[model samples]
Target: MGIGDVSKRVLLGRKLRSSQLGETLLPKRIALPVFASDALSSVAYAPDEIFIMLAVAGASAYAWSWKIGLLVALVMLTVVASYRQTVHAYPSGGGDYEVATVNLGRNAGITVGSALLVDYVLTVAVSISSASQYAAGAIPALVGHEATAAVVAVALLAAVNLRGVRESGTFFAVPTYLFMLAILGMCGYGVMRLLAGDLPEAESADLVIEPAAGWEGPLGQVALFFLLARAFSSGCAALTGVEAISNGVPAFRKPKSTNAATTLLLLGLIAISMMMSVIVLAKQMSIRYVDPHELDRLRTAGGDALPEGYEQHPVISQIAAGVFDHFPPGFYFVVTVTGVILVLAANTAFNGFPVLGSILAQDGLAPRSLGSRGDRLAYSNGIVFLAVLSMLLIWIFDAETTKLIQLYIVGVFVSFNLSQLGMIRHWTRHLRTERDPAARRKMVRSRAINTFGLTLTAVVLAVVLLTKFIAGAWITIIAMLVFFLVMRAIGKHYEEVELELAADEQDKVMPTRVHAIVLTSKLHKPTLRALAFAKATRPNVLEAVYVDIDSRATNQMLREWDERRLDVPLKVLHSPYREVVRPIVDYALEIRRANPRGVVAVFIPEYVVGRWWEQLLHNQTALRLKGRLLFAPGVMVTSVPYQLESSQAARDRRRRDDHRVKAGDLRRGRVVRDDDQNQVGR
Candidate 1:
């Protein structure tokens, strides 16, 4: 093997064969973590968002946190229920995009795709940023460097996800369940303390949050309503991962749709319970919270700014600290797990985004690269793309969850509202054709569910837009528009290519004559080798061609051609503009125009090298020539590579990389990733 292959294997682990894909298919235990991590991780920071919004009006607004949580819960329940219908209706894993396209037309499908693309990007950004903040709070050395930490977290998450959805899901399920258990356990204990009339106070309970500029003091009823709306909109981050279940129904074992729907329902219930409990507990304990930048506004009981370097823990962290203060280790455990869950939450996006991208690619709405599966049956390119984009956002925003959260939930709510509206249309259209009485009743019932979901989510989207458009919602809107145009362009290009490649009698008919052109930079072994190969082909016409960008080089080559008396005829194309591709492309087109039935075979002599820099040194001209030639009609470009000696080292490196320890290496016996999987024996 080559050095490149060795490096990849050493860094990324073994390259699983196509037959070993079954080893990557995760069971329910692991799948839950992989798919549910994002929603479960929201408990780490969702409570903090609710409290921060409520803290704008001093302690009085804090009472409404629970109410907002319940509202979010209601919407989440409706959304989960609606998606259950979707999974059953479209078991193909196309999710909302498929639902909309099947019923609402191509435009709606494109809209859903755009919205989902934006939402997935935001999911990675928000989750990683939240995890970074949590880490900063837990580790003092991490302060002021959370942005860097967030990027690193994103890289790690991407690596895990590139291992494949089922495998990532299995690894994630533990953290998802652990996070759920930890928060629920803490909430239950806090309730017991409340009943005993000895519930402890939060660390921030003694601190006061001074509201930001316009959010202060007693306001009119309209203003109050607006404030509440803004708060509700922010709390909707909990719904970011809800659509994933619809996109991942096919990942489940037998009865994929049924299992996915059940998982979705469990996610909703768990999320609601966790979010509401955290909010209520924070309110009861007077947990003080503020936007990251406004941390300067919070003061202690003695009317002093809290210590300089003071790390403001999140509401859940504060609650955990207070609730488990007597057990120091337990407090740290809770905090650690919460942070871990946030990072893991991004796993949901990793699983969902690639699946969606693959479907889009299959339909020619996304780049073909998205449809390319890796050795482990994972959409690796998609994972890498998300990771890089998320890293940029984290770095730009300093990994401050408060700042990043502004850009969080808008796209999700947009998708939800559109998807629910589309689902209503889908059921209505189906009911027209599906005339069985029982089926009609079911469709009507499903439509009602979707209708309610649409109404609820539309209101949330409007609130989100009103509150966050200036803050960051425009970012989401712009991203959606960009994706919409890109996808449309891809679809158009694919259609154009399909039309261009359509076959007829002319396509099958052999060319009337073959015209050969050999690219000659200088008269050497490469040029001589090309001449011999062309002679072997015995084309009707053959000549050596060179772009004369410089007079001295052309004159020197012409004199050499005369002195050497080369077998092939030499022809130089004059170009005063010093262009590389355009002149050659035009010449090839002119040749095709002269004889429409002729095939112009352009042979490019290229050097094959092992090192990255060697590639830069060689094939600079041939690569560009080939790219331009492909766009010209009736032309075929072939690379005739003479492998350089450096390539041998690369080959050796590749062989070493593919060598791996087998399944039975351990004393405890073999540990197969997927139990039902079997090896592809040689």
Candidate 2:
């Protein structure tokens, strides 16, 4: 139809009617990648974070890597189990926010909502930033421009997601599955090599790690405990995306809760296995990894620093290199899929955040626009909002995964702790009236699971605050506070507006009289049409009003009006300041003040043009006058459109679009061929 419409059609495909929303429901196969990619992709960076935190104490502390992995796995499993109960209980898809609100109080619900919103934004930032790091390492061209690459990646991801959840999920399902296969296949082969006693060491195995300042000697139990706690806190990033599935339960097809619960189980198990495998394999292969910024800590066995510009590979990459040493394709495939999957991991957030935003909007805690679906049946506003916020974070942090990682997980854990606590309360409250013995037993079991989850997550949240507050976690806390305050203010505003807009008996009363004024600048077709329309309304009083910015034209129009012997009277208001809009506005306000029980109707003629540039050529005064009159009490502004000849172009374009053939026209028997029409006529 138009350039913009064609471009949008190409980018987002054809728009679907509201009835097609059911067609967009994701099956379990597609839902896994859509909702679980974030949790699954964490294996790509969780192990690296674990090693980086442990590297501060040098490689000697690396022996605890597997222990931290196990601890994280335990927390992840507990969270997954807890959320299964959540999905079953709250299949309407409010997830943590709903649970907290219903069981706890409004404040607690808002806290969970604010926390989840912040976490979803951070999910996209961290996931895409990590992907950028992998890409930079694989392709040296992107080394210095990681932030730029990350921003572009985020933009493209948002575009794909704007097409709708089911479509985006189908698109991302391939890479997500490939990543799972690559990592699992690599782990399986690595385990086989280990069993055969032929597993080779990583490329960095020969390098020795030097402990940072104050950690050169053996540490006391207190120091060791603190070091382990920091490492564990960082490792717990694996649990970040577990709640997304709970938030996205409605996206799944038939038996939504069951499919979602199954997906969550698969996510937890696969993520745990991959993370544990990577950490164990790295340990077995003696992968000497450290913070990328602190590469100086790595030295050769002869006490010599590494060659200048030596780049340290991530833990998974090193393990892939060692495991696939004999097969170059295997290594490349693993690396390629790992990078791709990290980018697609942001898709999970893209889906979850919008749905959560919609829920918040429905609750009056977010802008109403967030609750509306775009033409493609997606929450386009929410998606764009998340993308912009994430790009800002990526730019601010320079797309450094390590730096961004510190601000990660804090919000998710905040939601996790509150959600689990709420779930416990949920089951407790239901058990009071759930007198069926079988259902009561089930409720008790779920409560116990939630209780355990709460204990573990509470401990993790405290440890995260304790270990990461100075390491940039404070930024996340401040962000959550800002979200909380903003949402509260929005809810309050909505409530006040609802009260103000409530209709009263006085609202039904009609105005005592109608005072009509047709705004005229010249005695031409548009002005004549406006005057005729105003007279047709049969108001109590009617006059043609003009703002005399140009006296000569005004006098000439007056002479023509008198020559034509027009029945309607013309009233001219002289403007010394050459202002056209203010005089009309003041006149209308004066009339409104004089007749408080009456309505003043101002009629203005506006030109309708087809070409975009023609719009700026006319209607300037009418636009300004209408804008001013809208705010005056009891004043009504009506636009009488005068379509120019060029306006036919827009009407013709719409007519052509209406006849365009769509995909299902043939099958639906809606297509008509000229030949068929002629035969029917005969």
Candidate 3:
């Protein structure tokens, strides 16, 4: 009906009724990629990190790669199992924050919330960064501009996520699955080659790696253990998105927890297998991977640097290149799918952030706006917020996965450890109240699972802290602290406001007297009408108050009032400050303090016009005066609308179009229809 509506439909497509949300409920087939992409996608960069840590002390430390990967996998499996319990026990979608807060106290919950929030933002940043790298690999022209490409990828991700979750998920599902297939397919072929003793080394295998400043020549146990710990910490990146399924349980259909748990288990198995296999293949193939910028440090046996601009491909890139050494198309396919999967990985955060935001809003920790569902049954505000925050981070970090990944898993593990501890406490408390033997037995078993998860994750959290605190873990710690404080402040403010504005016995008490004031700028029809309306209320005292900034105008008004002999007295207050609202508010407050039990009713005449710009020209002062007066104790500010000639047209248009489009609708064009997802919002 309007240009505003027209633009929205163009960007976000047609508007659907709020009742059709169920139509967006994900089936298992689509749901897997929607939520699992983050953890699954981490394999692309996680292995590279592990190799980097190992190569720090030279390649001799490389033997620890598989051991660290196995340890990380074991921890991941524990985390997944624990979260399966989390989803089942708490499926309202608050995830770790809700569980920790409910069981471990508000402090723990806030910690988890901050961690989760930070993690979600990084999920977008890291995923988009990885996608950019993959994009560069696929297209040589994008080489030096990978950071720019990464940022563009993030921008594209933000746009798609703005549409809504189910829609975005469906769109991302294909690439995520393709990535899984590619990696799994690569690993399977590498296994066959290994069996046949014919696998080729990576193209860059001949390039030597010079260790960082500290490790010149190290067979020392201390250096080896340190390298192993660092590698283990780096491999921990694989666990970054494991908690998403727990956070996103409600996104599933009926039996939400069961569906979510199954997804989690499948994610763990697939991720562990894919990751371990890739790491093994890379080592066996003698993939000469190093930090791209550090490639000049690498030298061949003859002591010559491998050549300038020697583009070292990523772990997957190396594997893909080696596996498809002769078959160029297979390498291209792997690169293409890897790029798609990395970009799509952000969808996991898109799904989780909105759901968590809705829960936070309900608990009065976030803005009430997040509590409302959009036409697509999604928490649209939350989704957009996540997108914008992630985009900002992506831009700031230049979408370099290596740089962005520094801020990655610390938050996720913070949530993981806290959530598990909370679940353990939850089981303990539940067991105390349980009378039924079978349910009690189940609780005991769950407690055991959670306890194991807590131990494992706590160790991982400690390892991450010890190994990475200086390597950007502190950034995440600071972020969690910031989020925790913010949530607490929001909660406090909401509580205070709720208490101050609360309707109760005290609020119902009537004032001893009512003193009504009519604001008059001139003796026009509108001012006269407001005067008459104020008098009809029959207050104990009634006065027409005018701010006398202009003496000539005030004199003319006084003379007219005197000649007319109006029923209510006219009081003109001189404002040397020439302030419109301040003088009126001070006058009202003086009357209130003099008679503390009396109520002040301030009535201002306001102009209502049809066109948008026309309305801005009139009644600005009256609106300001009314706004100021409302803050006074025992004061009621009312706007008496004087309809302009154009107002009728505006009203007719409003009558023809009635819809409440809150946030996130500015981009959508107006094409309203009954969409399935919108049904949930109804």
Candidate 4:
């Protein structure tokens, strides 16, 4: 293997056959982490957001943290149930975009698609940024360079996912499960300690919180309502990845919808449980957290400020520290696993965004390149695209989770509202045609569920807009609008191209005359081959066209043409500006202008090289000439490739590669038995 191939194999592992796609499908246990990691990992930071927002009003408002969690959990449950209907109704993995397009109109679908696209990008950015924050907390050396750490984390995740879905999932499964175990086990043991009246207070319990200036004397009902609304909206970050399962139904094993739904239920239950437990424990232990910049608000019991650079640990970190203080290993275990899982949470977007991009490409709404899978049978282009976008966001926001969080749940809620509305329409339309009484009843129940989901999500959407619009949420909105316009423009462009290319009687008509011109620089093997091929066509007009870039070579070529007694005529196009492509292009156009009714076929002699540097060394002039000639009317550009020795080596290498066994060969029914193999060997 070449160095490049070996490096690729090392980075992405072995390529899987298309038949191995079934092996990539996940059972519920694996799918839970694969699709639900984002939602599950939010338990690490979602409560932090809630506490931070409430901290603005001092510890007095902290009493409402669990209430906000309940509300957010309620919305999550509604979304999960609504999407269960979606999975069963459209198990082809179209998810929200498909539901909106089919039941609502194309514009609605595009809006949902754009929202989901932006949401996926933010998922990676937010999750990785949060992970970096946790890493910095655990390792103080990484404190100031969070953005750089997050960028590196994103690169690592993208590389793992490029290997294929199942491999990536397997790689991440252990950490995700460990995070669940650590957090839940901590919560369970903390509760037991509390019941025994031996629960320890959080490290920050002695620090008194001072409410922000405007919130110090909160007395009006309007003020309290707005404060709670803001806290609730921030808490809803937990719901960011709930819809990933809907978009990834096809990646599940047989009975895909059922498995996806079960995974979705598990995600909601675990995320809700963890979030509530952390909030309650923080309150029970008097954990104090505020915006990182507002550390002045925290005071010692003596009414003195804490020392400079007093970094407040995250809510979960503090809770873990307090709950496992006696068992130092448990605290380290929870902290380590939480940070790892938060980073891997971005894996959900890596898997989801690519599949959605592929579907969009298939629908002509995205770049066609996204539809092509890489050697590992994964959407490698989409994976790289997501990584680049996430890196840009992390750089722009400096990988600060609080800043990135403002741009968070807005896109998700936009998709949620639209998708729930779409699901309602989907069930309504189906109810009209579904004849069985039981199925009708089921459709009615599902429609009702979607309706409730829509209502709840619409309210949350309003709150997200109202609370977060100025806090960077408008960036998410603008991104969605840009994506929607770009997709619409792409669809329109494809439609115009298809219409223009439709076949008709004119397509079948032969040209009045065939005029062939072989583009050549010298009378060497490549040029001679081009001339011979052009003559084989037996055109009414055949000539060799050369631009006089160098007088010495031109003179030598003319002398060889005459001395060799070549049957084809040789024409020299002079260039005063010392340009190659324009002279030859002008000559081709001049010929077409003279014989407007005839076709001008320009055959350019080109060298095919296996090495990358060889490609750069040759074919500069020929490539430019062909590109210019193709746009001219009544002109056809053709390349007669002359393969170099390197090309033969490349061909042999490919032959050897084609014979190697891949992951899904047996499932594809292409496996050979031992008897046939032995006969061939003999």
TM-score of each: 0.87, 0.97, 0.90, 0.95
Better of 1 and 2 by TM-score: 2
Candidate 4 stretches greater than 4 Å from native: 646-682
Q: lDDT rank, highest first?
A: 2, 4, 3, 1
In the range 1-682, model 3's lDDT, one tens digit per residue, is 5677677766676656767667778878788998999999888888999998888777766777888899989998888889888889998888899999998888887788788889999888888877777777768999888767766776677667667667888898888888898999989998998999889988767767888787887458877777788888888989888888888887788878889888889999999999999999988988766677677768897888666566677889889989988888888888788878888888888888888888888888888897787755678788778877877877777767777777778898888888888898899988888999999999999999999998988887788888888878788788778888888899899999998888888778878999999988889988888988888888999999999899999999999999998888999999997888898889899999989999899988888887778867987887677667667888888788889889888777776555555344444543343656351111
Candidate 2 to truth, TM: 0.97
State the weakest 10-residue window (summed lDDT) of model 3. Answer: 673-682
Query: Residue 24 deviation, candidate 1, in Å?
Result: 2.9
Candidate 1 residues 14-65, lDDT tens each? Answer: 6777886666765556666777778877777777777777777776688788
Instruction: Indicate the TM-score of model 3.
Output: 0.90
Model 4 scores a TM of 0.95
Off by over 4 Å in 3: 14-18, 133-156, 432-441, 502-504, 559-565, 654-682
lDDT of 4: 0.90
**Candidate 4 residues 1-682, lDDT tens each?**
6679889998998778888889888988889999889999889888988999999889888899989989999999999999988899899888999998988889998999999999999999999998888788778899899999999999999999999998998988888999999999999999999999999999999999998988888548998899999999999999989999999999999999899888888888898899999999999999989999899999999999999879888888888899988889998999889888889999999988999999999999999999999999999999999999999999999999888888998988988988988888878888889999999999999999999999999999999999999999999999999999999999999999999999999898888898899987888899999888888888889999888878998999899999999988999998878998888778888888998889989998999998888989999887777777778999988899999999899889877767766656666665665844531111
Tens digits of per-residue lDDT for model 2 on 310-352? Answer: 8788888889999999999999999999989999999999999
Point to the candidate with the largest lDDT.
2
Q: For model 2, what is the alpha-carbon lDDT of residue 43? A: 90
Residue 292 lDDT (model 3) = 70
